[model samples]
Target: MSFAERYGPWAVIAGASEGTGREFARQIAAQGLNCILIARREGPLKELAEQIRAESGVECVTASVDLAKPDAAEQIAAVAGDREVGLYVNNAGADPNGKRFLDNDLQNWVDLAQRNVMTTLKTAYLFAGPMRARGRGGVLLVNSGACYGGSSFMATYSASKAFDLCFAEGLWAELRNHGVDVLSLVLGQTDTPAYRTLLAEKGLPLPTNWASPVEVAKVGLAQLPHGPVYNWGQTNDVAGYAPNSPDQRRARVLMIEQHSRSTFGDD
Candidate 1:
């Protein structure tokens, strides 16, 4: 089966307003999948949906939702209706305010956790079930190099991303046999509107080296079937991106699976 045949008819993107998430929606639509675009900004989200419909000739559904809210996942599901969501791109988590842990408001951290961790789990559980039953689909979690280790600032963000990485990998292992591809698309310093806004707010210059949202989305789609993880650019050696070889990550997943099976008697 083709890409659309295996994972098509409809796809949902969690952060489809701009940057990488927007790119992912466009790419998915281009591949013959109708799109459900979700974002906090309604105007941009609707504009993107119209653009996708015009450019790709596919139906586009727009949902303005704050993923940090407790009912965010349910809101998305409502927008998706009963359409089979063959692809789910969880790209809603990004910490634009790069403040030290204590410097930021406690509520901000809570909301971030809700958005990145809780909503992710809920949506994945919602969509992955049907995908597993159907025997084909994909879950693409857009992560970051910050996930590799702790950082002075962005403590909550890093921690959340680490959780996402581990979650995606585990899901990949569990669903690969069921024909559901799960990929943690780990990126390093991508050139996105949010990143630029954050830097501008801090009065800092743009990084000389940054990944392109377009390329990142393309690589993510191409590498979905080869999952557990794909470290984009392999840059940011300091944050431990370079050391994340695909073979090593895959082996680690297998190793942990073996340990779990042995300990639990594989149910």
Candidate 2:
């Protein structure tokens, strides 16, 4: 059976151990899309794979590799080989502590770039080759909404996502007429395990009306066709870039950065 036929379509997601990445896997499972779940920790990924297979009744494969390591892309690509990949979700990333950009350790930036930028870029590029040749495929890059302007504390994370936004949209335009769909999700606050930890550490209240993983996943996946650039919200995350209000885009980012840094020492 063909890829789109066997699993009904297949999606490979990086950073599948937790948060949005895990949700993406479950969402793909709901679509009957066979999934290859990748992450640094094998335990969580394997557990997630089993849960997806059992709950959604779709096949799930797990790969544990630090996508930041050299040659990691090749290793991931080899396993992903010709599975007739129809969808690729580049969701792996790390948030450097809220620190002044220059004051932080240099290695943190390198590590973030390797995971947030290089890994995702290489995987997407490798996957797109088959997707393009097959004339059918979809790609979704999970990014922070901070890319609109970014934050002082979260500088590196925000800039890294900016790369994903550009890459996805550019590819979307190229593939639009060719049958491949490339999309980006500029995600807002979500209810994940990390939120509580961050909140407790910072001694701050949780953001009101934050989204859940399932909610974000449903909207993000549905909006893939509208083509690159979507904001996850109460419903579909298909909203394009925001209006040009002075602070609607940039002000909040700055405020959040200031607050986040003040609460926890920037890493």
Candidate 3:
């Protein structure tokens, strides 16, 4: 089947206002799927929706709900209405406060968990169930290189992203035979608006060789069927116990999964 036939009718993209999320909206729409755009910023979402409609000639829906809130999934569903959503992209879970764990407010970490962990899990449960029944759909969880290991100032962020990575891997195993694709798109130093803003706040200049959001989005969609995980750049491919090479990680997951199935009899 074609891309649209396999994962289309409609695709819901959280964090759809800008950067990689915006590019995902564009790329997915270009491939013939209508889009439901969700972000806390209403203006950007509406602008993107209009652009997608005009450019791709596909229906566009917009929702301005904070993904950190408990009712985020409900708001998204209400916006989506009864559309048979075939793809769900969880991309709203960026770490806003790039400070030491103790330097940040407790509430900030909690809200981060709500956005990155709780909301992601909720939306997966919401959208993936129907997709599995339909037998052809996808879930792309945008993740970070920090997930590979802990960092000095990225404690909670790293931990939450690790959760996302493992969750996607497990989901990939469960849904692979059911015709639902799941990917953890792990990124490193991408040139996103959010990254620029964070750098500006810290009085730092842009890096010379950051990954492009457009290319990242393109590769992510192309690699959806081959996941478990996609480590976007060599920044993640290191010589250590926790190597972040996509092929290595994929092999490890498959190996462990085979062992589990053999031991537990695929119950």
List candidate 3 stretches off by more than 4 Å: 234-244, 262-264
Stretches of candidate 2 off by over 4 Å are: 1-8, 234-267
List CA RMSD, all candidates: 2.1, 10.1, 2.0
Error of 1 at 140 (Å): 0.1
Across residues 120-176, which tens digit of lDDT does each residue of candidate 1 receive?
999999999999999999999999888888889978998999899889988998999
Q: Worst 10-residue stretch by lDDT in candidate 1?
A: 234-243
Decoy 2 TM-score against native: 0.82
Over 1-267, each residue of candidate 2 has an lDDT whose tens digit, in order, gives: 443542247788887888878998887887778899988899999999989988989888888888778677888888777676788887776573566789899888888888878888788888887777777888888877777777787788888888887677667756765677777777777777666677768778988888888777778777777655666652332234443322232334345555777887553
Each prediction's TM-score against the native?
0.95, 0.82, 0.94
Clashes of each: 0, 1, 0
lDDT of 3: 0.90
lDDT of 3 by residue, 134-223 (tens): 999999999998888998889999999999999999899889989999999988888888899999999998999889989989989988
Residue 214 C-alpha lDDT in model 2:
78
Q: In candidate 1, which residue ranges exceed 4 Å CA deviation?
A: 235-243, 265-267
Clash count (model 3, backbone only):
0
**In model 3, how large is the Cα lDDT of residue 213?**
85
Clashing pairs in 1: none
